[model samples]
Target chain A: MSELELQNKKVAALASTETIDGEIATLNLGPTHPATHGIFQNILQVDGERILSAEQTVGYIHRAFEKLAERRPYNQITPITDRLNYCSSPINNMGWHMTVEKLIGAEMPKRVDYMRVIVMELARIADHLVCNSVIGVDTGALTGFTYMFQEREKIYDIYEEICGARLTTNVGRIGGFDRDFNKEFITKLRAFLKEFPKKFDEFGALLERNRIFMDRTIGAGPITAERALSYSFAGPNLRAAGVDYDVRVMKPYSSYQDFDFTIPVGNDGDTYDRFMVRQQEIRESLKIITQALENMPEGDYHADIPSFYLPPKEEVYSSMEALIYHFKIVMGETPIPAGEVYHSVEGGNGELGYYLVSDGGRTPYRLHFRRPCFIYYQAYPEMITGSLLSDAILTMSSMNVIAGELDA
Target chain B: MSEFANTIKDSLLEKFTKTSYELDGYGEHNFFMSQDEIHPAIEFLKNNGFIYLTDITGSHYPEKEGAEFQVVYHIHNLSENLRIRLKVDLSEKDVHVPSMTDLFAGANWMERETFDFFGIIFEGHPNLTRILNVDDMDYHPMKKEYALEDETRTDKDDTFFGR
Candidate 1:
């Protein structure tokens, strides 16, 4: 056959399997796909470039966090919480601590609450930056990712000064912080607060209104407000769908009610809308941290609950009561009250809730993490149903489904 | 319970007379209902401003006779800024509860996760297979009977560790 005829034959063969209507091909998006950024497996049925349906297989990294939490003493469980949504692990740690405090009815000091607000806001900024920057990376924009990552490093440095750890920071204790912010922490935070805005605004200007970014994300994987709610979407994802339901504003845990920050809501609930919502939320988080720091309360760093908080080393060495309490706590013998409490915090991704059922034991009888990633990720297949495979990847990044959080 | 929770309780009690309401730990609203009343009560709540389904999870209570499993649903009313926890106790003999996927699409995975962990079956779940665990695994890992540490491990014996 002639060369033209051979080309025609090849086109016909391709059309038979790929180009023709209703001809579907299965694509495995990952148990390990680079663009996914996490260990999520989506068995996508594609009609050419358009996705017909997506069946996701999660739990590839399921560590059985709830089961493990049931066995560990309340304090030991903080480390486990660190792994969930590790991008904003401080929020998880604090949320767990607050849940325990609520069960025990330990009233935290105003200073502790303010300190928590600052740390939680910093963690939120870190989480949103990771998510939004990943969205940019998915859309072939690498400069913004690099820039924001440097800023995230500064936040991590602050975390290091506070807790002596960076990522997966087990930052706080049951009633409040393990220790008050040191001079170094405050100085670093102040520096971060001063320098962060200029760099952040530069990053924002790079993609917020850029024609390429907008075109790539504007209507990709859009979901209506009603559908978004039905899917139990939370955080920036839900806000992108035009819902103004922020857990911070709605519930006001950790003295969030005292801060003055606006909740940004978007209209489209698409990749672009999700991106913008997170962008504006970082600004709101900055506002919250500044406010919390400006109005820093004067009091103890942690609550006066001796049974929960570890006594000072000097006291533990000199005082019998301190020695006994410290030994009891270290041995996982702290007397936790029997109660059922569901406490939620505005986590980096969404409303991170802890449903703790204590049976008056040292450890929780049952602990359920109301992981926002796991709940909202169920909507992914629906969101990207008719969109291109590229859009599917973008949508996944925009949803900010951390595999740890999703599988926890 | 707060005033808003009381309002919800009154409305819920008015509709579902078989349900019981109380303030849970931290004074949050909690409703205890039979398996039959869950779907209708939740539907009513959905119609009455509790549209957001926050989470669905199950806790295993092997010691509790006749009610070995408890399924919990946390729903939020965004307009009122109130949250209510609804629970249904399932007997070991019949570990099935009606799925709320019809009401909240988010409940699909939550119910699946519940089933995966506690073996609490959601009767109407479109896909009720194990979500976070291997499909061939014989037992749910979250049940109290399953020890947190693996029994099959031999190297980390308590005697060897001087316990």
Candidate 2:
């Protein structure tokens, strides 16, 4: 084929798949470039400044979590989940814990639930801070970026107080927490509750009203409710399109029913609407944290299921029964019923679901993680089409497609 | 089970004759369908208000007779706040099922991922190729028949880890 004919054939295939009209310039964005946040590539067919079509290439960081989960024991798989959307790993840890608890029929007490709620809300705030501030940085405003980083550090300090690790926190256990929250931890969390919202509002003031930021985001990458629903958009992305569907409200798990908070919704699913929806969601998370702290119940932090929760370390060293229980858990010898369960929580980005199938084994017969970022990123190519190249970056930042979650 | 979920279960049992079990009594339904019956079953559920497709995944069973591969669909009805799981079994020789991309655009990547990991083909899918795995990978990694450890590694002995 001649060169012109080859270009025509390329356009022909692109037109049939992505549907772009007339001739266009092709621009390849990166596999290792900073624009994607995580590692993914976008090949865009552009007509000058306007993007006619975009083709996304993902899986740069695929670790085969499904294949790997088949070999490891149930507890060993917790660390694997921490890598998916590492920005908010507590939700992943707690979501996995609840799925296993459901399988083993372990019921936790109200105190355990409240403590979990507190940790989960803190993770949600950390996730939104990264998203909103990154959106600000994309708009050429750096002040909010640095300001929000400090608040995120406070969240890390809280995580360090609870668990040793911060970013990829493998914190919770199958039935409950490894230990109860100490007085020191509760005090630190209350301090965070008092201090974070003010910094959050100050950061919002920098971008929510700035003229240049508003013009760049108001109409960029707008997705209709019909298309958004058809595409299975969830969390803030779906909420930004005027749909009030939230997993926490529609399907409450982990004692979320006891908490009262409003779901934030937006009129247009544009860049501006997505940012605003997350901003309001941060406020709602603050309200939930305060309520969970005030009405905190008193009981064991973990369920009394010995097979699910490890015995105390001191008892393990002193008592034979405790040592045997510790050995059973460490060696993955606990019994599990043969059944299937699907449990989901309102993750930082959207609905984080774990579909686990157990065949009376210590490990899972089959485990599937229904990551929201993986599902929501499908609409990216469609959303970015007909927008400018720079606006495509803004749309991606708003979507917050962590490469870790995308490739998993 | 919730009232609406049980209602869905009764309706589905009447039509498909598949047994409905209350999984953990958690307001969800589980049932199985033949490969040939899945397209119409999905269409029936969609018409009945299961507007959102939550996920499309595959599970491999190496020893089951006439059901070597299981293609599972997690569908949700946002209006009623209901979720249902429909599983279809296909033999190793014939691992093909009709695609739901026509119904849900979100199934595009999920179907591709299922195809990449489990080697199940979607007959009418517009594009079906390796998604999470490198395009050059020759075999489906999720199949139990495949070795868990990398075959290329030579330094470690298999007996030490009890592989």
Give model 2's DockQ, 2 decimals.
0.60
In CAPRI terms, model 2 is classed as medium
- The 10 consecutive residues of candidate 1 chain A with the worst lDDT sum are A2-11
lDDT of 2: 0.85
Query: Mind giving the per-residue lDDT tens digits that candidate 2 earns over B1-163?
Result: 6887777777777877654444655545777887777877788888888988888888988899889999989999888888889899889999989988877878888999999989999988877988888899999888888877877899987542322
lDDT of 1 by residue, A1-408 (tens): 632254346545544555547677889889999888999999987778977667889889998888877767889999999999999999999999988888999898999999999999999999999999999899999999999999999999999998999998998888788788999999999999999999999999999999999999999999999989998988899999999988888888888888888999999899999999999999999998999999998999988989889999999999999999999887777777788999898898888989989988778899999899998998898788767899999999999999999998
- Model 2 C-alpha lDDT per residue in residues A331-398, reported as the tens digit of each score: 77777788888888888888888988888776788999898899989898778866778999999999
Scored against the true structure, residue B148 in model 1 reaches a CA lDDT of 72
Residue-pair clashes per prediction, in order, are 0, 0
What value does the lDDT take at residue B35 in candidate 1?
92
Q: What is the lDDT of residue B124 in candidate 2?
A: 86
